[model samples]
Target: MAGMVEQVGPPGRDDITAYAAERTGGASVRVGALAPLTRPGWVQAGRHLLAGMELAVSEVNDGGGIAGRPLELVVRDTAADPRRAGAAVEELAGLGVAALAGEYHSVVARAAARAHALGLPFLCSSAVLDALTEEPTDRVARLSPPQSHGWQVYADFLLRAGHERIALATEPSVYWASGAGILREYVAPRGGTVIELDARALTPAGLCDELAGHRASALLLLAGHPEPAVSIVRSVRRDPRLAEVTIGAPAGQPEFAEWATLLGDEGTAIPFLRYLPERLSPLGARVEAALRARLAHPPSFVAFEGYDTIAVLADALRAGGAGRTRPAADWSRVTVEGTRGRIRFSRTPGISVWQWTGAPVQVVDRDPSEPGRFRVLHGG
Candidate 1:
């Protein structure tokens, strides 16, 4: 919303592709988009991410675009596969997109590796994997808080909630393992014990049995959604022994609509991490309204991340297109007025990408009384 581009206009049409198409005419400055639009991916998160990105693209076009060239979004569905994502990055690079933006976690990791190798600037929209690339490089900058930071915040929330005996329902993944390790390390130093449950080997009922036997006060889901997550929640809620146990999802599974659509009332009160400020800036407020109108639902934090990703890239492109964003050597110099706040990137100690350290993080959940609403229980 700052720099050469103007603020987004008021919400009018939900169909942004049609709206963007009607107003723009030029060679077009294309920004390649990544998302898990299909199965094996969190499709709802992808949908929300795309909604925000699409809204930003439309707004960039309406503002006379970059150097009079219309801004364009070339989307590729990552389909939740790492190899598939790597291929997408290679293909997008070949397509001559000015930069890249995204939705998948591991999917983004794979894309990050390839993008880093090719020196393609990638503004990651949602992935939080700590080791996005094998080594440090300037080619990738991230909008989301990393797994270490966000999951540590979640661990603190659990500690404050008097949940000292915690259990993790973990699936096999470097991402999941990293998150669990973060929580364990943060919680253990404060006298909490973390138990790991094999989500792959255990049925929902067996998971519930393990939870009850341990007398664990809290259960954190570090597994995939719908399959084990939904079933685990259901089994735990139905079992009388686990009634008092707290349910958490540090991976943000409950943030999507389908989490509620599948689990319904049982899913309420299960806290998850979301990266949103307690209050939105005026720019964030306007974009939130537009995104809600476009999405026909309250936009998640991931949606805001998508919008901010485009916003940062657009500002860099306007300043100087490829020279500013192609190699991403200027990530430190990129300071754009994003929807959330002023966005800037810097090197973090453990992270490999140019990290936005200021993005807000919160622990929130659907209220049990009103399943449609979210209640902010903790924030950092």
Candidate 2:
């Protein structure tokens, strides 16, 4: 009988802590997707947006469906248009989604603000421009590092590389312009200056003339448009003086590779800051499979971001005692692990910063295998 006891499952190790899966229940939380899904230009990034949201949903469901009730997502395509974004928000609210995510473009973020005003919490994953946070609502939360943090990281990279004098090519849009300003603010205080070049409507001659005057050590592309940024890089690289300067960008879009191809082998050496490593995400793989399964191709960062936004919201809802009470933790303790990074909102200043969240900024060597892929050079 003693020999037959068989250890009894190793004495049960320890008591089981209640997992997130244990409590999720009925009255399914309706999570919404707000994005420019219809626009071809946005198609590249938007796919990643959706993947992030889907990943969160799928993972929650797989882990016993969030407090016993599975999450249901309501997706809305904003088509990169503000008017359409507003309409989609109305539609999702009508369907009664408990929370929402997505909307990378600042234009669409405004639409999200309207939805949040109506009581739905809008948790953004990809849209990081500071303007999005200015919208008054406790319902809005962002997981991505703000543009200021990203700018500082980029500036630090250039400065550390000994490129103290820099030239900037920036888009006129609030997102890029404000991002450039933030970069300048960070760079200037550190004894470096960033000269701005407004590329909104600059002719080739105008761009050349501006480039000719500056004895720049580095070039920073503050423009969001890949075409223009690539064009500038290609044009500048031809000039012997500019060819020697290091070119830096926030993130490399596939279009940057096209630009690299045009610029030749020299372009491959350009360094960029990556917010999220493409291959680092387990959810990214799942997102790609889902996109290929449904849409016949893999998704992009924007789509995965959209999916992640929803995933974070689902976590918050689950942690918030399923609407019973707020997830009451102090500012330092108030954190939610998000797809992009850990999210913690500041209680006093009442704005989000990368420091409190503990997200690392990485300087990466762009992947040779995939132009969009990257390997961490410093931080991970």
Candidate 3:
């Protein structure tokens, strides 16, 4: 999909006779796409992610269907469970999907990547964990920037904002721990200090007490959504002693529309990291409009990540990764003009998976005056 998704309307279908096969009474090149579709998972993010993948698949199929065979997406709901995700990866592989793509949670993606040790290529979509796998392999590639990369950007934003003494309210999760560690490492030498607060041990009120006692000007939420994160925000906002504190969620929790629906105007101005450029490319604009129609709301960067995942996979199939062992995660040959920018994979020193080095990273938040609008605070 070199100049990928140039036109974003209904994908035009080609010859149907070429689509005959044993399964579904038709021939389709299948890619198993995973997302957290049910509860305990971020459903809004999943919905947007799926929407983008679906749209891209439709376009790919319409655009002549990978050597005239229809492109198919076999989607499974991970539900934020690592074990379930591992199982899903096995099932998808058994069903003979040419490759695997899409997973939002880092922990769950790690599980799927582990199960994927069986040798199927996996193109990871939203997960940003630096160590996606316990060890590196040639069979996997990633779309989102790693935790270390994005967190460094967020840390830089914090330093520029003069929030040297920061408080990170965190849960006991690998993803959260990695993020907290990244912020601490990146901010410390620059004269910033990170204070860790155990969100699990601290009630919202107690967390507020800690924030006040520590006198931290900035508090970054590194915990799960709606529970501790939302609760902590509510408590901090209500506490008079913490009125001057700047609350942040660099984990991109505030990117989804549901965040706004849940926290309303209060969610505005709480900066979070998002993977979008300051301005959309022509292809991005078209995809963004199409995504809005499908999602019935503005699509988050996760949705664009999903769309770009398909665009790259489709291009890879065209480049011959559809054969049994040569799957779409082949980073060397892929050069997709994605919705955000040109997608190309390379090895950075610390990142384990084949990573797209050019995905744009930004720190943005909903405008306080107009909660529906997003304002970019920093970009890197």
Candidate 4:
């Protein structure tokens, strides 16, 4: 029976405690949210991520919450910095958050060592580094496939598309490095050859020259950021010799509209590995509508992942109650209907930790006429 509560500025320890006290009336479940709210590179993505988390929290509270206790989010800004991320987790722990979620950068998620140390259940929303959940731990889980698994899916798509020689290009980052490594490991054994290129170091002319020099049937641009990937694709498409080369990117998955607009005609028919299906589930539809109403755009992959993270956490809380250690075990058995598909987790191969392995991985391309619409080439 409490009125809607709103707080201005970034949440601090005292802010979180006071907000929860005012909103929950002393009986609420607090989930910690660590994201890059003001980071230079990740501010927009961070906003959408927070929006999704808020949507999920609102829906859970509207539905009587977990075991009739209101769910509250204690948000902190990490700015995608590793040290800040680790400290944010520690701060959240000090605030007595039952679980933690919301991180977009792999470097930041890697700093989740504190979550393991504190034994608080941490669900990574969108960080895709393979090592995030590589080690077995009862306190950690990820909702997105690791870079290796996602790249393997991309490799399979390329193989099925009759492309044998693939050129891999990427920026210098841990996220892209893990993806490139997986592409190399997966492509060679499958009778495919990979030509690797450092996209960050390449000038537009140099990129075109390199693409012209290689007889690659397709180019896999794995830049973790969108600008480099868009630049590479735009440059490659201009080369007459490589005019027909199939272009794909993992970076475009999160921010598809910007990539598509930057590439223009060049973006058509290009494949990208994405976490969500082209179509939404009933829950997905509701989330998309809510996002459109709130943010004036449909939920992006980051938003969907964020929504699912809290949904999964709520399910775990409902089953195990608050303050229960080892919620990862409970998370492993939870199968919530998410925006993408039926959300579930299992121990990832090679990583040896429970992860949301069933995330809908699809190779989708932008519709030439409809800039925002994507057509699924493979998977669903």
Best by TM-score: 3
**Pick by lDDT: which candidate is best?**
3
Instruction: Say which prediction, candidate 1 or candidate 3, comes out ahead on lDDT.
Output: 3
For model 3, residues 136-183, the per-residue Cα lDDT tens digits are: 777788999998989999999989999989999999999999898899
**Ten-residue segment with the worst summed lDDT in candidate 1?**
1-10
* Candidate 1 Cα lDDT to native: 0.82
lDDT tens digits, residues 203-277, model 4?
A: 866877787687888988776445666667777877788877888775554353555556677777777767787
Cα error of candidate 4 at position 90, Å: 1.8
- Where is the poorest 10-residue window by lDDT in model 3? 1-10
Candidate 2 whole-model C-alpha lDDT, 0 to 1: 0.60
TM per candidate? 0.92, 0.75, 0.93, 0.88
| lDDT-best of 3 and 4 | 3
The TM-score between candidate 1 and the true structure equals 0.92
Cα error of candidate 4 at position 267, Å: 3.6
- Number of backbone collisions per candidate: 0, 25, 2, 0
lDDT of each: 0.82, 0.60, 0.85, 0.75
Cα lDDT tens digits for candidate 2, 81-195: 7787787778777766666667767657755667655666677766666666453456666656666776677778778878778887777677777777777788888899888
Model 3 misplaced regions, further than 4 Å: 1-26, 325-329
Q: Flag clash pairs in model 3.
A: 12-62, 19-27
Q: Write candidate 1's Cα lDDT for 170-281 as tens digits.
A: 9998888888888889988899999999999999899998998999999999898877899889999999999899999988898988888888899999999999988999
